[model samples]
Target: MMTLALQRLQNTFGYDSFRPPQDQVIEALLAGRDALVLMPTGGGKSLCYQLPALVRDGVGVVVSPLIALMEDQVRALSLLGIRAAFLNSTLDTESAWQVEGALRKGELDLLYIAPERLLQPRTLELLHHCRIALFAIDEAHCVSQWGHDFRPEYLKLSALHEQFPAVPRIALTATADARTRQEIIHRLGLEQAEVFVRGFDRPNIRYRITQKQNARSQLKRFLETEHPNDAGIVYCLSRRKVEETAQWLSDQGWTALPYHAGLSAEVRQAHQHRFLTEEGVVVVATIAFGMGIDKPNVRFVAHLDLPKSVEAYYQETGRAGRDGEPADAWMVYGLQDVIFLRQMLEGSDAGPEQKRIERQRLEAMLGLCEITTCRRQSLLAYFGESEHPPCGNCDTCLDPVETWDGTEAARKALSAVYRTGQRFGVSYVIDVLLGKTTEKVTANGHDRLSTFGIGTDLDLKAWRSLFRQLVARGLLEVDTEGYGALRLSAACRPLLKGEVCLELRQDKRQSGGRRRQVSTDQRLTLPQRELWEALRGLRRELAEQQDVPPYVIFHDATLLEMVQRQPGSLGQLAQVSGVGKSKLERYGDAFLEVLQAHRGDAADL
Candidate 1:
């Protein structure tokens, strides 16, 4: 049975085999067993459910939260000649009726519906009448309040399992922490379900976080230097910011567009279409974007502001390098970001305990932003996993930061905060240190303090770095409600009593020859760098021919491997990790010919 399933995956889906954890989940589902699958974004989570739907005797019902997701999946499956359709808010009356008719006729192998729509009485009655071979819940993390994308509608999905107790069910998500995992099981009433947790490392993505200073200029530098003509997503925290950033990038001559909930439906659809169809388009967006986008050529994901938590950050960053090629997950954060995030959390209507948990989450994200250690290691650790020896890809690992014994410096900084009654922001504190005696400083009577001007030896940037590091290390907290006042955490106790030593990364000059060297080394290499364009072109040709997603034919990883290997024959091509006998049999000859001809011409030169 597994062999036949593999053959179908090859002949119909055009894949040679399943990714790890995919077949396991499928087998469980085939046995009429429930399962909770936790895989990463690019880990082939969809195949676990989609393949089983094809083999099952009746229609497989897929419950998804995002309408865009349902539509994309249905279209992709339909292109592969699978009998698939989605019923969502986007469907007109006639289209909905047609889909209903198809379901009644057992024409759809897989049917996707929004959870809210599925809970309707009429919809439930229709589902009851139609034979259901399996039930799948995508983005299952939405059922957990601890997750970033929680929805009230997902709670009702449990009743579906209750009503159809005999049908096999599987819940899948790309991002979920330990707490969220438990919540999903309880909320879905899957007590006896098998659980599969894939490893949480996105090894291909180079994680980077720069301190937020002259952010627009820094972003421009990244665009010009590292990813000149590649497709990428620039995430902003708000709709207004998305529009501003999009316009700003466009004015600077990049093919950029804005996408947010604020845009009209037609405009949003147009923007999405352009992003998917076009190359080198930088989509500036809020969290509303990229949930179900099937584009696989995005080479980078840049966050202009800090995300609310590590889970949100992981999922957003997961958007990059999905094609399994080398991609970047770059972000810029600062002291003000921490303050802003805390303020947002405080303003939420959540209960005090929820607020407390959220604060911890925010602090964890801040730690990743501020740490001198490898960003990848710290991030993985937060998800209850660890990366040994750290990844050599991130900025910290590639270029080790210089550390200074700042125990005395930290003591003085803490004294300054204490002397000021922990009521001042970083700038005012810096002014007092530099002995500027500005009007606000004098008004606060801070100049009379014994610690005033004590940090004059260090420059303003160094002072800022010190305070930022303090806040990141949990020795201090920002009072967001009090206009971003600096408050000491309990960890500050030891430092105040000289019980612990402080070591801090020296503040590197934000601009100079060193910056130039770093930027140049980080620049994308030719061909390997051009892989995105080359793959997109190949994808366009393949998609046009096969009527399937570019991703379905061969992902970014496979294309990059092809370019790197320039395989001259079917045997050499099969050596690539993702290319198996089925894929080679289907499309290998043509791709290899192209690669050989290109390589041959280059060699002649």
Candidate 2:
């Protein structure tokens, strides 16, 4: 039976071996044991359950979180010649009935539906009549109230355990901390399942966090430097910002699009389609845009604002480099982001305990940004692991920041906040400290104070960095109710009294964008380049005809393999990593013809 599973892996998925721990997971499920898989995104979580469903006797039922994710998965699986279908609001009653009928008749290998739809009485009754091989719950962290993407409907998923007690179940998620992990296990009733805690580090992604000086120009510089002519995602904090930034990027000659909850369904779908199908399109969006995105070629993920926690930041940035290629997770944020997030947390309807936990998480995230050590080390430590050394990929390791003793500057800034009545915002306080003759400072008569003009040694950008560091370190607090006024926290008392010293990173001047030193296109010979483009052109044409994303036809990795190998026939092409048997039969000849044409042209030369 295990040999049969291996054969299925090669024949159906076109891979000769399993990624680490995948075979163990498949073995566990095949042996009638449940599993709790904590693999990262793009870690082959789907194969753990999908392979078992194929080798086992009945249909595998997957409880997915989003309609778009489910649809994308089904389309991708279908391209591999698997009989997969999804049941959700996207399907009409007639189409829904057809999928259900296929399930009852044992004509489907896998069936995906939303958790809300699965918990309905009719759906449960229908499933009870069919032979269910197993239950797979994706995005299992959604069951935890503490998780960033928690969905209330996920709470009802334990019903699968109660009703289908005989069927093996597997719960999987890409992001979950200690608390979120336990909550997932408790809520999903997976106490008996074997826990797989894969490491949380994404070493391929180069983490870069910069203090915002000019956000629009900073983002423009980053896009131009690291990700030119590549697909990426730029996350804003608001819908209006998403729209404005998308338009601005488009005006700057990038293929940019906007996505958020504010757009109509049709418009959102169209934009998402273009993002998926078209290469080099950058999607400027809020956090809502990424949960359903299965595009694997996103070269970078840029955050225009601070995420609420390390988990949120990790999950959003994990969307990049899904193909295990080099990618970037770049962000530009400032003091106001900290205040805005804190204000939102305080004003939310969550209970005191929840709020406290969230506050702790936010502090941890801030600490990650401010740490002088390796960013990967701090991030992994936050998730309760510490096996890694300094990763040379992050900004801290690439170009280490310089630190200066800011003891006197800290006291001056703190005193400025106090002398100004602890009611002014950062800009106003900085102006008074810098001895600016602005009307606000002159009207308030702050120029006459002894603390005024006391800290002219640092420039405006340096002052801003000091304020942001002070806020992040808990030496200062934002008066959310007073419209972001600066308030000195008790933590600053020691610093103000010279009892403590603050060592802060020296603010570096923002430089022009640097050109990328390496390019993927440089790997190919002239002949191979011609063949690569021809293969890509064929894939794009087929995607347009089939009305599916080009990746659903074949991923770039698979095409790259084809170009390098120059397979002359279907048998050789079938040996490629992502070329399953069905796809080989359907489109292999067309691609081979293109390859042949390219070969002929090169020979004539």
Give lDDT tens digits, candidate 1, residues 414-490. 88888899998888878887788888888888889888888888887788888888877878777757588887889
Per TM-score, the best of the predicted structures is 2
Clashing pairs in 2: none
lDDT (Cα) of model 2: 0.88
lDDT score for residue 125 of model 1: 93
What overall lDDT goes with each candidate model?
0.81, 0.88
- lDDT by residue for model 2 over 144-250, one digit each (tens)? 89778889999988898999999999999888998888998899999999998788888778898888889999988888777779999999989999999999999
Minimum summed lDDT over a 10-residue window in model 1 is located at 512-521
